[model samples]
Target: MPSSIFINQLYRPPSSSSPETLPSPNTGVRAFHQSLPGYKPSPLVSVPAIAARQGIRWCLVKDETERLGLPAFKILGASWATYRALGERLGLRENGDVVSLQRLAEAAKAEGVVLFAATDGNHGRAVARMAGYLGVGARIYVPSLLDEEAISKIRGEGAEVVVYDGDYDQTVLATKVAAENHAEGKGVLISDTALTVDDETANWIVEGYQTMFDEMEEQVLEITGTRTITHVVTPVGVGSLTQAVVTHFQRTPRSPKPMVIAVEPKSAACLKASLEAGEMTSVKTEYTICTGMCCGTLSAIGWPMLKSGISAAVAVEDSDVDTATKNLQSCGINAGPCGAASLAALESLSSGEELALGPQSVVVLLCTEGRRGYEMRSNSQPEP
Candidate 1:
């Protein structure tokens, strides 16, 4: 198998990261192995009782809260794409450190590099952290339901953060407006999902997810002693990380790839509607307990990956998220609404019995983020 496959192709492992093998027009696809060194893998914990009580024997938790000091899965995709996009523009290799992001920000400031994105919590934080570390000024648009603590963390990362009027989907539109209003040139929108391919940032973000699958593969081996994943679940807000998982795993040794499930809130099931409609579509996003799943529109880049028969999208209730949060904590793990959405979907799936939960099949859930989302979970109102 090749070290890395093309963006459209399936997953394959090339030899470990090598400077000579970095993807080039001449060399084809290259792994960004050394591009960002010191990446520690996320731990995959076993939820035996959670699985057993749910009528399944076991479930694996791909805990990503500890990624690069961030408490979410957003960094896996965002950081990978950021470095790759910068590397391409500057003629740098995967092994090359190239120009520091701080220096590039100064130069980019002349040209005006302003990052933009709408998030419930994690995605915006990832963008803010990346832009701050790279020295580029960024304006992150977020919903009113966004946690103050998460926003403060993003602000600490040096991005000018804006709390928009409504939900995550509305914030996405507001962000587009902010990026277009960049008269001083500080508004280059760094969105993860869109139809146009001109911005290579999303693709790079997806690359960051590759390392995630790499970590997941290790966990699968250590826990199961075999790499065959039967079913996988991931929470979707923007779908960048979800798409990356599908893309990476689809290329692996599992020919009939695991049943990839998309977990979203029923109140704002953009990806769910898109899947049912068989196109990139949007749903009427209402204020819900699961603020993260309140994304109104589907990310165009991520939709194609989903529509390719790689996923089974499902809308989960708020109670499941609440229960999952408490469940994770009970198991000594911290996961917020967005992070627990995957497990929530699993519960729904378990009840649905569509995928048939049993001991023979190994289920993997992407515990995407930490309790930084605790502030925004709308427990005051009724469940979704």
Candidate 2:
């Protein structure tokens, strides 16, 4: 019920038996991304102050605060998945040179395609932005609990925003049904998470996320002159990004694959619950400032790999995230609650020796978003 860590007992060393359909270390997804306009690698920052405090050899932060003109890394997956999905429908070459957003817009407009998606915030906005690039219509669905600022951003992209009267999981189902029932038969659901394992678009979304990890590895090598990242702490929503993290590290030729650590809001610790149950499990979530991570279910496509791939799972309280956000800000890292959750997880580990991280351990915290507005937990609680 409080901030806690679960060291996975079923964890195994990286194996070769992972699903072949998912992204691999050798994929051309990054190449595809490189062809997009305004494509640049996000910064990998050294937080020496935190490193010294935590007694770790290095504490690195992959700053995805601003990626591709978006405030979060969700655009990485959204853009790539959008391109791939459109390319398939339009008979465009996969991994072919993307001439420009305008050219893609022309082609997609000629094809009568419309994008449909559900989001807590960032992912839906990314999807809508991509639809705008393609000159296509988009309808974004959101849970009733999403903040108005996020909903407005989605609408700003010229996408019709539909507020679902339920939680994120229900919103996803509503989007799927809406896409399927599109009267014009032109709706394409570009979802990052899926209820089924073999959803092609969902798989592409997972593949799209490899660009972030690829860039992180290159930056880590540049800093250490070797692939020395021993632990990767990631904030988990539906686990798509974390799945990308596990796949990249597991398949990397680096001598030892980095230990994968997943962090989520304590109220929405579905992955941790599933890991403990030795089967996929869902949780009833409550309000958390880490709104992007307030998902109640583990992504079905990611569950198999995450079952054995992750070394540890952490669930942090909103108060912990508030403190982490302030720490990151003091370090000049403008991170939102979701972005700061990785730091919160690290600090949770530092309070005890559960992970046994020592001076030799080199850790990378994936900060996935920039600063955003949210009520602080301390202020949100009613006075006794």
Candidate 3:
């Protein structure tokens, strides 16, 4: 790491080789991406044996914690979305970081093309990264309340910034409105949430997440020599990545289904509540330690898939997020609050008791980010 670098949270996911069998015709789109914006991070990470000793069985952490040098699982969704969107407009792919609007402009085959989005953090960074690689210019709108440190990082990526004087949700709404206005008044708008749900781009973005699962699958085999994954714990906001996990496992030809547990900050557990209600629903939405999970509305595409497919949905409090982070730290892993939401949920599921797993069971926690949440820590000490 550079001596000048500081710490914080960001989002992303990764890789499995193409299956020998063909991709199902109606399943999520499979893309062979190289040097793309998102990552194909290593999935089979070694955590301390505490989880295994607890009889948690084949517990594994699919660590995207180190992805793109950011600490969250959002990059896969955002970067894939950006790549395809650019392909749609420029016929050229963006294979760079979010901070290069100038680079994107240089790659533009069509005249006067740009990209736009509203995000809490990682999503904006990803959009900016893609725009940097593919467009003439890119702009991002964020909530007035986002951490400035995060904003600085995004700006460093060469994006023009619009700060909405409201919460993150407000930033999302305002950005969408701005993009709509820009499209109507000028020429076009590129929406991120559509990638969070259904649309060819979103679907492809979700498929990119399959790589994350692919790596985990290999890790599980290497660690336990068992292909059986009994449970998978994940964090959700609008449920894009959550759906990605579920969709991947569902399409996978295993006999028994892995329990898909969707964890979120209680205040922003839109998908959890929607699954309970058996339909897509919205909540008031609020701030939480897990900023990445603070979504008020459900992604229409994700809601139905999760409601039908998920084994359980859990809403965790901020304290649990802190605890999950501490636990990951003890294991020498750095994960953001959103990244550790899965471990937090699993901790609650076990009632804080040592897990009791039989030989046949293997539990996996997707540690979705690394050091990115250091910004939210009480002390912004340099990472260990």
Per TM-score, the best of the predicted structures is: 2
Off by over 4 Å in 3: 1-32, 37-40, 52-54, 91-110, 183-192, 195-198, 351-359, 373-384
**Model 2 steric clash total:** 0
Model 1 error, position 61 (Å)? 0.5
TM-score of 3: 0.79
Please list the Cα RMSD from the true structure of every candidate, rounded to 1 decimal place. 7.3, 2.7, 9.1
Candidate 2 lDDT over 1-384, as tens digits, reads 433889998888675544465454536678877866688999999999999999998999999899888899998889888887777767666356444556667888987888999999999999998887778999999998888888998899899999999989999999999998986778889998989988888888888888888788789889988888888999999999998888887766775667899999887899999999899999977778888888999889999999999999999889999999999999989999999999999998853455658998899999998999887655356422
C-alpha lDDT score of every prediction, in listed order? 0.68, 0.86, 0.63
Superposed Cα deviation of residue 323, candidate 2 (Å): 0.7
Q: List, residue by residue over 223-281, the lDDT tens digit for candidate 3.
A: 77667787788877777788788777766767566767778777777776665556677
Please, what are the lDDT tens digits per residue for candidate 1 over residues 1-384?
Answer: 211101112222222213242322211112443334345677899989888877765689998767777887677667656655655654554355545544555565456567787777677788788786666777888877666787888788887888887766667777888887887644666677664645466676666677777778888988988887877888776677777766666555564467677787777777766666667777776666566566787666676556653446777667778888888889878887777888877776544445546767688989887875453345346433
**Span of ten consecutive residues with least summed lDDT in model 3:** 4-13
Best prediction by lDDT: 2
Which of the two, 2 or 3, has more lDDT? 2
